[model samples]
Target: MTAPDLEQRADHIVEQIDRFVADGKRVVLSSSFQTQSLPLLHLVSRSRGVTVYFLDTGYHFPETLEFRDQVTEQLGLDVVSLHSATTKAAQVGPHGHLLFAEDPDYCCYLNKTAPMETVAAASDIWISGVRRDQSETRRQLDEFVVRSDGTTRYHPMLDWTEPMIADYQERHDLPRHPLDDRGYVSIGCAPCTRNIPGSDRGGRWFGMEKTECGLHVDLVR
Candidate 1:
């Protein structure tokens, strides 16, 4: 998309957000604090009372934590950090290895998805940075979707491509995640992520068949 096109989309997003706020709907945003997350982070910063939630799964790279803190401080974002109720030591399997090695889905549920469920249940709108160009699963998502629990999953940047994201980040002079320079495009937990050569979400979940960590699919009712 061209710069003018992106600008138009951004304007529409602002209007939509304003309408939601006007309706007195509780608005919340969840971010993974990656480079791709910057555009939405910056956009939502313009709106007041939009609390950004970061699920601290206790498995993120040190750089990711630093990046989250950096962006929150720089943008003055009202970020709330959520952590799993389960202790890291208790995330182990019967064999004493991490549950991610045995059952990644269950591991994600306990760590990432479960912690966000309560917040999503109470909020009227949940803004996401999920882009169509990121993954096959995300490509099927619409700009606005009401989940089973009545919380609307809003994807304002759903149509944005890789180039558009890069252009926007450059235009805003955004601070990138430290791992972005090393080809970690779609970052997640350190053990599940890898250095893929492209901008898409191929780096996430690595060799596993799973794509999403279940925030988009299972976090709602």
Candidate 2:
């Protein structure tokens, strides 16, 4: 897509967001604060009163936290941190191992999906920066998804690719996550994240069959 196409697409998304707000819909955005997430963050920043929710899973890299803080300050966003109702110490399995080691699904449920379900249940629209080309699962996603609970999941960045993100970042001079320079293209919890060459989501969940952290799958269910 050319510069004009990108600008038009962005304007369309902003128009929809503004329409939602005009209708008195409660719009909320969930961000992971990764480098790729900057485009959507910048897009949403065009509107006012949209609170950005970050799920602080208690297992994030310190650099991810710092990036989140830096982005929040830079964007002048209304950012809110959500945590699991269960304490980190309480997230253990039968063998006294951390739930992420024995049962990643359960760990994700406790840390991310549950907290986000609450936000989705209460909000009229939930915006996320999930791109289609990033992973197979996300490739099946649509621009707007109305969940079972009646909340709309909007993915304005769904059609955007890595090159588009890079161009936008360069154009806007957005800051990148510190780990991005080290090859952590798709940032998540430190334990399940690694540096995998040539694939956006290859490092996530490392060797596990699971790709998503359940916010995209289970939260809507």
Candidate 3:
């Protein structure tokens, strides 16, 4: 879709969110505060009372954590921080040291997905910043979806492109993730993430085939 088209779609999405809020639905936004996440964060910030969920995986770069806090404070967001039941040290006891290297998927399940499942159990709507252009796995996702758990998963920026995101951030003066300046396009857990050229998600899970952290994939199940 063109930039104009995506902007129109974004407007419609905000309207839908407003309507959901008016109807007293429990709406929440899940954000990673990555390079492309600011636009969606800005969008949801405009709607009062929508709680933003940030998965505190305990392994994220210090820069990411700082940026998350900056965005929360700057936007005055109603943010809810989520963390795994197991501590990193405790997880290592059972899964072995460097569990992310041994089994990234399972590690993600423990840290990311499990916390989100708890959030999904209580939320009626889940707003996310996922865009089709980010990865092949996300390309097939619909802008609006009904999860198996009965929560409505809404992707307000599903049709957006990198240029659109840059434009929106510039227009709104939204803060960029600090790691983005260092060429880290897709920021996540520090150990599993790196700098890769061209692709936005190329840095994620570096050598492995894993693209998504289980949060997006498992939330529907």
Predictions: Cα RMSD each: 1.9, 1.6, 2.1
Pick the TM-score winner.
2
Candidate closer to the true structure by TM-score (higher is better), 2 or 3? 2
Worst 10 residues of 3 by lDDT: 90-99
Candidate 2 lDDT over 1-221, as tens digits, reads 78888888888988999999999999999999898888888888898869999999999999999999999989888999999999878999999999999999999999999998899899999999888787778888888888878999988888888898888888889998998778777889989998986678889999999999987863331
* 22-83: candidate 1 lDDT, tens digit per residue: 89999999999998899889888877778999999988999999999999999999999999
Specify the poorest-scoring 10-residue window by lDDT in model 1. Answer: 212-221
lDDT for model 2:
0.88
Candidate 1 error regions (>4 Å): 218-221
* Model 2 RMSD, rounded to 1 decimal: 1.6
Mark the regions of model 2 whose C-alpha exceeds 4 Å error after superposition: 218-221
Best by lDDT: 2
Off by over 4 Å in 3: 1-7, 93-95, 218-221
Candidate 3 residue pairs in clash (backbone atoms < 3 Å): none
Candidates ranked, most accurate by lDDT first: 2, 1, 3
